[model samples]
Target: MHQIEKETVLDVRGLRTEFGLAECPLVAVDDVSFQVKAGEILGLVGESGSGKSITLRSILGIVRPRGRVWGEILWKGRDLVPLDEAALRRVRGREIAMIFQEPMSSLNPLLTVGLQISENLAAHTDLNSKERKARAIELLDMVGIPAARNRLGDYPHEFSGGMRQRVMIAIALASNPQLLLADEPTTALDVTIQDQILRLIQALSRDLGMAVILVTHDMGVVAETCDRVAVMYGGRLCETGLTADVIADARHPYSLGLLRSIPRDVAPRTPLYSIPGAPPSLNALPAGCAFTARCPVAGPECRDVRPSLETTGRQRQVACHHREEALIHFSAREAAQ
Candidate 1:
């Protein structure tokens, strides 16, 4: 076994979450499973409402009321889903931390940024108020906030968007977590700032030996930052493999469609093809394959059978029928079609 796959810090099995409604239930996350190894960055990529964010939230035991969650969320051999809220809170930000999407909303507008960070440290650590303040400044400094000692007195509104994100990351890292769940951390930032944030996350993953789960919609960012990637469609995982392998030899029609829609920078753009039809709504999933409606090469078989995660190679899996044909000379096939 590869070192990356063997030393997994987080292993999710058969994770499924459904929300109740009057007529139909909203299956936000459906049987999605993957492992994040120690010090590895696993990127979760998909369109909005693909359950990437919801899955991360469920891991934190923050799934909404009327939501039925099944399966195990394993961390260090223990199941987290069954843990009480108080126990989970203690585990969170210490053993496992999360940087939520939209740092501005996550941060307290009224409190000083340092206090916000200190509160996290105070919750987990036995540090005194003075000691916590010192640690909070150090955390801010580690995240590249200059004059952090002075910045401790400043509120979230005082800093720019990028700086606010750094503070959010600082708070997430305050307790020295073993795993970091970054839910679309760069979604609201500019491209230049996004690169900076991604690089910082990569640095932290390496420097601290912390596993990172990066939830994002940008395939290009995954190509740059993630060691491995999993693609989701309609609350289900479509494909997963080494970032390079998945990008080069995608074995699912949904994966192929995502790659085709976003032509790489090196590729000469030819009208920048878009996938036909929108992503399926979680409240009303299609029968069999959720992506059948949009898949270019979808067949009757795809419409009749729902494929589970099938290992096509070591540490590589794809949920799709006609996987063989999906990996065939995609560029040539596109031109010919």
Candidate 2:
């Protein structure tokens, strides 16, 4: 994937998001960088509170009032970090759209589904009242909502979980955005519905040639959907590579642990592997590697010095002191098991 050249849609560099007091702020995202090319799906995967969602919010300049975001968010070569609210408003939803995790909370309860989709159309497109209504129906139909014309007046609660998600996707696709940011788009849905939502997103991206950054805690979802994966831990990227390469040969210890933690069909009573210890508290993060306490191969240097993300192979980057040795150690352990 990296060998072939493609148009870069989004290039994030040294992104740091902070909240709370300025003097002693909680670093939600630290020195994170990645790129998304046209018609590509980049998975931002990690455990909860790993700054995956915050990174997306920061990129859109939608962080809470108490929070501050720094670093370059280059969308089609334009840096969005320094843009004012008015400038950002023009970029968001028009050129870049986001599908939130929970459609119920994200969608307005008082507004009808038609009106909600029309609102985005009005905001981003030049469609008039009649045109907006017709486009809304088309969008709904495109997202596979049955009886799209008749369901225009339905409220958020009137639809099932899966239908609500489709409506959200319809709203996101209202303006034909070039980039889509999806934050756990299938959260709380059943497995079957989750698959539908994931497939819909993948198909839409391919059809529209839209670059997507999908945030999720599930590595299994990444394995199935993403072309590239960036594994984050305690607000920092641990490893990034093509999904297949990372799944088969992860270089970071945390990335390896996450891959090994996925549930597999084994004999009855077989225990699933789980990462030991919890993620580090953002406010109390260590000066060295955040995973030092939980890392199986952590050495004295890992406890004292932080490792910067370094190129390990083609299209692969890892932030670990023992990148080479970690792969060997984890591979042997999995073989033994």
Best-matching candidate per TM-score: 2
* Tens-digit lDDT string for candidate 2 (1-337): 5776779989999999999899889999999999999999999999998999999999999995677999899999999999989999999999999999999999999999999999999999998999999999999999999999999999999999999999999999999999999999999999999999999999999998999999999999999999999999899998999999999888899998998898776668888899999998997788889899999889889878999999888899999998777788887887887
| lDDT (Cα, tens digit) per residue for candidate 1, span 1-337 | 6544448788999999988773677788888889889999999999888899989988888885557678999999999988888889888889999999998999999999988988898899999999998999899999999999999999999999999999999999998999999999987789899999999999999998999999998888999999999999899999999999998888888788778777655355556767778888775687689998877667898877898889988678989887876667466667674
The candidate 1 region of ten consecutive residues with least summed lDDT is 263-272
Q: Report residue 248 deviation for candidate 2 (angstroms).
A: 1.1
Question: Could you give me the TM-score of model 2 versus the true structure?
Answer: 0.97
How many collisions between residues are there in candidate 2? 0
Clashing pairs in 2: none
Highest lDDT model number: 2
